[model samples]
Target: MRFSTGLAAASVLMLASAAWAQEAAPVVASVSAPASEWRAVAAENLLVIDTDKGRVLVELAPEVAPGHVERIRLLAGRGFFDNLLWHRVIDHFMAQTGDPLGSGEGQSPYPDLKAEFTFRRDSQTPFTAVAAPAGSVVGFLRSLPVQSQPDALMAKMEGGRVSAWGLYCPGVAGMARDDAPDSANSQFFLMRQPYPSLEKRYTIWGRVVSGLDVVRALKFSPNPDGIVTGPDRMTRVRVASDLPEAERPAVQVLDTNSARFRALADAARQAKGADFSVCDIDLPVQVAGAPAA
Candidate 1:
């Protein structure tokens, strides 16, 4: 099954309806938080993609989409994703790749994965709410923007939890599927802009913590199909844990639960007023020991 861009317009409308005033807020160069306010990303959860253009580092969220994360880790570890063409790239939207055929109609040998549109969030989940609307809470689940049912509803549910889904913010990574709900295999896309309509439709497994500019810089097609001629390709893709000690990149993200993050969120809310969204916050990330883009 192919990843389709037919609903691009509808996606924009849905985001607008949700009062998302602007694109993702630009990430600040640095944040002045104490060492304790920062948390290191585990090597196993880091997906490193070195494209012809640059290196893109994504922080995989296994808690949000465990199966999809496993698929990515498996593929990357086996060198299945290396040298795959980014055949489809939409301007201000996303870049799609991981098809061996270099066309949309391709997939890994593995069976299609069950859709993981949303996940259950219990009291043990690491959610730091930034805003509470009428019924839902918008927050961060370890750097990924998310919206979930209020914590109060957890007591009323049979599982003692509520549902939470990742927001389609810029730099977020989502699995691509066909018309079928569970058709996702190996093809995926890195979002270049926010599109809320995809929030519960596609499975989001991670978010790009570094080299977002490289994602946006991908070649996009003027044609409505977004199929590029002579498109860029991923030179190499590997999980950080698989790389040697000196080759592994280290990443640290500002803890959303920290007071510094709260101040940052407050400033953003004050600036955007009623139009603020959790997607508007770009959590600070620090990357070290990675190859230069």
Candidate 2:
């Protein structure tokens, strides 16, 4: 709706900051926005989430998690992760879901955000990175994959400069919260593996430029090892403003805000940190202006 509370969790340092994870919270998004309102940022440069299987492109870094990509593009253009499911398959690592109340604590009528840790890739991200190691809030976008920290610390306490929100992996999406950091609301996840304690806590924004094998074929529901049991139905979730605006799908997000993503993070930190394996890092995509595929 109209959304309240207002961005940055109403400041005052969101409760003087520090302290997080109340754990056990996913009821499937519907908190009802009020942590100070903000969520709504996708003028359209490519978002398309359409999942029944073949289409998972999510390149909305908006210069690094601009308020968690404008609150998941105003809640995935409103359909709010339609149907929501993909629960929590692990396999190679990653394939969570946006939990429209799969009960991961992800419910969000609104109001939750207040983490978005880092950003500083620049010129409004264009592409390239992959050196990986990051964790002050992450860095690296194509050489090995990972970003955020362009001007974080909440844009230096809401002063200016943005771009930086890469932390999770695999299909890397975000929202799901509870231990604090404003409590997320729309429970979300998608990182085949490599947590590193969820660098910058959690709120990753977007990734998976293409259909990571239908999110690695999703189908794991045991949880407890980490707490993500799902899949009842989700034969849906098609966003991109509900496609068909000539079949909306034009993409191009590799820019960690770009300078060739720090020269591919210096060729992925001088090559060979075991030669990459977070599914071989690949948030690279290209559908072009008129719906190419």
Candidate 3:
């Protein structure tokens, strides 16, 4: 679906009230932790994806790609992500989404970010990197798991500027676009599979933090034109705090800049990828406070 910059999307579910209306039940519901609880924390290192199945927590990278994190948070706060759908899926490659139009030919009101190619290659970039077999089809770059497509790799490697980028791993979330970098407005993609050609070429922004099963459950439909398909309808998307008593994604994001988070990152470094990828990185989240269902 294309981003309708002018509108505000709120959280909603698709229950047929007429068919399922029942007596008032004790509705213990899930809700996102209040932003007021966040206390103006940094962006990277903490992200949450509230999906129908459950909440997917993601650690963002504001230290590296600060602009994108700011813009994305702004949009999400304004309820921009509501009702969108993942549109393109390529088996063993990537699952793409973020077209507000549901047509894979749309964008948001925001401008494209200036490419953050490399941020000095900080192995300690707070990304929970994984170990990839050296001979595997795709491998990890200093813990940044790669999709390993030759073309995409070449593109990313061509410009070795010290810019930052989001590594495309299973469940890695990023922006999708036409050939031009400036064209990437709202469309995005997720790596259900891997595609290395993307490397530093596209706007590598964020990764999936949790609930990959919900992503896995998305349909693999391709359009006649190819390179796209609409994902399940996003009935509504609002910041967890904005949701009603019963319908918010339940989870708490670990403070990315917290001392505890730094400790966890260091611990992960010593740990091997028990089949972990960039998407496997867990940004901390927990169900907080009372339930509103």
Candidate 4:
């Protein structure tokens, strides 16, 4: 599903202004707690996409979109994404790639994936609530910001569990599907800004933990059809676990259960005020063994 919102575009400015008020150093220091306060990105789930523009590191979320994540892993392991162009990019919106043919209509020979837009949230899920107002709960399932319906609705659901899904915030990765919701295959897109209209329509499989600017810096299509004649291509894509030990990039994220994350979430809530959306906050990520900045 493809969606854009003028209101969300305006909301981006509000989030930007709030972010501008807080310096990176203090936040970094606060989030740099003990080793227990950080969760290392699993090697198998780490997606390393080296594009002509720069490298983009994505941490897959199997808990949220299992099928999509599995497909991404399959494609990357087979090198299906190598030399794939960012065929469609809209300024301040999103950067799309993963089509080997460099056209939006292309896909792998692999079978199409069914939509995994939302999943049943179980009690075992490690969701830390950041906001609970009335009937909804907004929280972090690790680094991903998610929203779930009220727990009271669980009994009405098929599995007696409430539904949850990741928000389409900046740096979030979503599968690009055709009009038929289940037509998604190899193509995907990364959000350059928050897009609420796309919240429940598209499946969010992973997130760009770092290098969001790299996504924003990609060459964009000038025409309305979102077709780029010659765009920066993803030269190579690999799962970190598949790489040799020396070539693997180690990454860690601030633990959501830690005081640091709570403090940051509170600060963001305070910063955005009346216009606060969960998208205003970004989970801090630390990278080593490679130049992330």
Model 3 weakest lDDT span, ten residues long: 5-14
Model 3 misplaced regions, further than 4 Å: 1-46, 52-54, 121-165, 222-230, 238-293
On a 0 to 100 scale, what is the lDDT of residue 157 in model 2? Answer: 43
The sequence of per-residue lDDT tens digits that candidate 1 reaches over residues 84-119 is 999988776789999999989999999999999999
TM-score per model over all chains:
0.93, 0.28, 0.56, 0.87
Quote model 2's TM-score: 0.28
Best by the lDDT measure:
1
Candidate 4: C-alpha lDDT: 0.79
Q: Which stretches of candidate 4 lie over 4 Å from their true place?
A: 1-30, 152-160, 290-293
Regions of model 2 farther than 4 Å from truth: 1-38, 43-46, 53-59, 65-93, 96-118, 121-165, 169-189, 192-194, 197-217, 220-243, 246-293
Residues 1-293, candidate 2, lDDT per residue (tens digit)? 11112222222232232222112111121222232231222326346665555566665555556776776767767777777876544443345566665544446677777776555555344433333345433444432245544333444544444455555544666555655566665656655444434556666766666665666665654432333444534444445655667776655434444444344444543443544433333433445443323
Task: Report the C-alpha lDDT of model 4 over 1-293, residue by residue, as the tens digit.
Answer: 22223223433554444343232211222455788888999999899988878888999899999999999999999999998989888665678888877767578999989999998797778788888867899987877889998777877877777889898778899988776678789989997766666777788999898788889899986655556777888888998898888888899998888888888888977876765777777788888885421
lDDT of 3 by residue, 75-121 (tens): 76676777676555544445555566666667677787665544433
Measured with C-alpha atoms, the lDDT of residue 32 in candidate 1 is 85
RMSD values, in order shown = 2.5, 18.5, 12.4, 4.6
Q: Which one wins by TM-score: 2 or 3?
A: 3
Whole-model Cα lDDT of every candidate shown, in order? 0.87, 0.49, 0.47, 0.79
Better of 3 and 4 by TM-score: 4
Deviation (Å) of 11 in candidate 4 = 16
